[model samples]
Target: MRSAPDDDRPGRVIPFGKGRDRAYDAYGHAYDADEARGDHGAERRVDHLTRFMDFLRRRVAGDYEVDEFGFDPELTDKVTLELMRPLYRTWFRVETLGAGDVPAESGALIVANHSGTLPLDALMLQVAMHDEVGRPLRLLGADLVYQLPVLNHLARKTGHTLACREDADRLLRKGEAVGVFPEGFKGVGKPFSERYRLQRFGRGGFVASAIRAGVPIVPCAIVGAEEIYPKIGDLPVLARILGLPYLPITPLFPWFGPLGLIPLPSKWMIEFGEPIRTDDYDPGAADDPMLVFNLTDHVREIMQQMLNELRLRRGHAFPPLF
Candidate 1:
């Protein structure tokens, strides 16, 4: 802020603010007595812009790296993260815990309960793992995820593959941190009243994949996603016509048109539980239905328990973002 031009105090800050005491922080930048005090935040913002420009230069020069699955770590870490970080940090005010429980050097199957009208929980989880655990979490998405027009390409680039047993097994065996939401559409499409409820584990396919790959299954519980976009009703006929899972009718959507697409800024919590070792059993143990069923139930129980605990701590659905 430019104050009185006559005030001739070089680098001397006059404290005046409603929220915080006024102060000027310069990144070792010089200041003149008559000139306006420079803000470090502004300088840092310019630095961010410069880095982004360099990233664009790299992309334009075809100098970025991409894996066989079309996964671009450079784009995800540098570009896609810019889109997700704000929501994870500001809008939703997401709190991630137990990230240390995730095995750092080994492949692990991260199984989490899915909610939120859209698959925003998944995106937030991706950001949380990247920021907190310093790992690129690969998500096992459903067929519908890849069927969407623009999302299809973006998902692949973000390291999200189809939620097929084969893909899950392959990614895990390759020592990648893979995430799976076993409830699929049932978890996301369920009514708001049924929020946080686990639908079903579906023949324990995810467990089988984990067993085959001999990876630890880490149960993750996420709270606050239930309130992001409360699903009051569904348009089944329209969904079928569009070849979509379900046409969600939230409190704001359809009635409000594009404005309805805005997700409610509910607080979010993510907790990664201790790993349930599938390596304890032989790789062929996946073939045994009973073993897979038991492990699936165990994981589901742990996730539910964690969710219940997190909700207790969260209190209200829409806490103040600040």
Candidate 2:
């Protein structure tokens, strides 16, 4: 009988075969061939853990700054935004157009249509600005966002505050990019049948805010978010009880439990239109009702037109074109 081959040898033959032996001995330290192959995955996990520890150390050592609103740039960039990047890149496969239209240095307002039962669109836009435009977007969110416990904390750390004129003006005056979804709950909770139909922007408040701050309004149109979780219906009573706008009824949700909440992978395209300057208008233009309405309508029209064009380019929301 042939002597048993040494299991620790790199090229040692085993009963399984030469290929199996090589794989089993790939990590040299392990005495058992079976254990060596299993260590590969553990090794990768160790590497990830090590990097994460380093990141935390930097944050804890005052290498990062947190703004008054609790916006921690380092944590948001390294941890929170990093977690969302895979979804933005691989799942949604977001394609950006007219990124240059966004002002690199000056303060500006980003006005966009909002949809998707969850405010995933907002998070994705945040990723886009950070990764593509190379700027941190300060988003103005609704009261509901700040009312939730854990969510409120994360939202602030990610640079979102209550959607009030005061907050918007403050951010803009500081030369920070501000984003607002004028449609509010009306656009987000609409039925699937009404998808992509722009809702009435609330009182042109965003327009007034932009005018007062003397910043340009950049119309942003996003396609593919409408289909994420098709809102077939809603339960108003439950929503009221839960203090939510509406209890969304998607195909899988409320029926399949938590597993159904997974969003369908949709191809996303975000385009920024040419900036509409507010500098020419008088300072009082913000207070003028008619002026605010006209400018609001103008931004809405531009977004709608862009939506139509993007929809035409992307044929189907699912099976999105690369």
Candidate 3:
């Protein structure tokens, strides 16, 4: 999410090469370079389509970059910390409650409540760590995100990979910080009726990942995102037809027509809670249903308490962004 240089402008579209379902452009090089420079811009759509198509064809034809999605430490640092500065300034007024608990070295599982209709909480947290605390946090993005054309490129460029034990263990074992929303898509899809009320977390995927890697679990709470795009209702049939996961009727969107997806600019607050040491648990503890349940319950409870406290401290349900 790094800032784009003045020279970086959105590119033109190109037709898909003969019979191909998608087109292509030279976008990945810029993407990688921008990430290295922490630059953000409207993705060169053609570039992504081209690269993806090439990747697909090559993979099917048995030739591709052997290390296609491998992590580039330096580039990731630039992208997450630098490019995303504008977003951090405009949307979130973030505060970390227990940044001190994050260790200087090694990987940790940052278990956080998923709010903000569009995953802005995670973006804000990444900027907070990179800009304020001087560390870069990699998010464990959902599989759905990777399905989008340009979004998938951005996610990979910004250091987000899939959320799974193998990826988590590999990254953690390599000494990189990983963020996970235990609530997954369910938390994000929770009705506006249940805003800020945490959904059920699966039994300890995050906790187990941490224990196996011997890292602490940092409980994080994000407030203000729930109200950003207050989803009041959904159109399931249309959503399915359009291939969109959910079609939200926000105050701005369906109510305001073209303006619906335009999030009413609201001041946001994000807080990072204390780290719970999972390293102390026996390696086999991940399988103990009772243990996972207790940990999941504890995280949910802490997030709820933090949400309430943040709501009270802020003293308003929503604040004007401008």
Top TM-score hit:
1
Model 2 has an lDDT value of 0.82
- Residue 143 in model 2: shift from native, Å? 0.3
Instruction: Determine the backbone clash count of candidate 1.
Output: 0
Q: Candidate 3 residues 66-182, lDDT tens each?
A: 223444433344334446666667645555556666765677778878875667777877766654544557788888788989888778766788887888888888887788888
TM-score of 1: 0.84
What TM-score should be assigned to candidate 2? 0.83
Per-model CA lDDT versus the true structure: 0.80, 0.82, 0.66
Clashing pairs in 2: none
**Cα-based lDDT at residue 218, candidate 2:** 96
lDDT of 2 by residue, 1-322 (tens): 2122232343221221111123222111214445435856686456446645545555565555578888876667666877998999999999988888999879999999999988899999988887677678899999999988999989999888999989999999999899999999999888999988899999999899889989999999989899899999899998999889988999989899997789889999999999999989887889999999999999999999999998888777877254
**Native-structure RMSD, model 2:** 12.8
Q: CA lDDT of 260 in candidate 3?
A: 67
lDDT of 1 by residue, 1-322 (tens): 3322222332222221111122222221223433343556576566545645555566677765677788877677656866898999999999989988999868999999999889899999998887777678899898887888999989999888998887888899889999999998899778999988888987799999988988899999989899988999999999999998899999998999999989998888899998988878998888999988898998999888899999898888886543
After the best TM-score superposition of candidate 3, give how far the Cα of residue 195 lies from its true spot, in angstroms. Answer: 1.8
Stretches > 4 Å off in candidate 3: 1-69, 72-83, 255-258, 319-322
Best by lDDT: 2
